[model samples]
Target: MANDKTSHEIGIDGAILATQVPGNNGTLILSIQQTSALNNWLLKWANYLQNEQTPRNEWLMTTILIKSKSLKIEHKIAGVSPQKIPDSQYQAQGQRVTWVLMAADIQTT
Candidate 1:
């Protein structure tokens, strides 16, 4: 179907649960299924921000996209700083973690 597109075409990065971008503040909390690949990806950005040396923490910026059959959303987070990650524990199936991060700028589209 040339004119038909499903949520499957959005190319989700991983098994996402939910996303929260609270108000005008540059804060984003993302909840997703816990996996080694996803853990590494999140930690990579957090570590980069931690190691970066710059004033106002403006050295880093990243974009997050959310898609579904009825809605399409995007958020641009800048100067992101790692906030929290779950501790190591033996969790059963469908265990999810909310990754907290703060940024200098949070743009929406």
Candidate 2:
């Protein structure tokens, strides 16, 4: 799913809520978290809100807990961390992180 929202809205509220829904097989809190994280990171890192890539289809969501406190900056600046959930178990594809979701695995929380 593609989302065009701020990181705070998606990450703090959206992701947290998504982490509480049940799926066809069972509850998929983990998937929700991962997806939320992916979306959140993209918003912050890729800066998709301003100038976005057209036909943005190829993207990935990774399950990443905050590695210590995250510092939200334009790019990589020194000694800056924001309030984030640390110690994430992010699953990565290549050098980037993404959350792979199954068809039946939908988040309700």
Best TM-score goes to which candidate?
Answer: 1
Clashes of 1: 0
Q: What tens digits encode model 2's per-residue C-alpha lDDT throughout 1-109?
A: 2232223325644563223333222111222343465656744644442236633432323222223345532211222222223234546632332332222222222
Q: How well is each residue in 3-48 modelled by candidate 1, as lDDT tens digits?
A: 2222332237766454433344456777776775787698766666
Best by lDDT: 1
RMSD of each: 15.2, 18.7
Alpha-carbon error at 78 in model 1, in Å? 2.1
lDDT (C-alpha, whole model) for all candidates: 0.58, 0.33
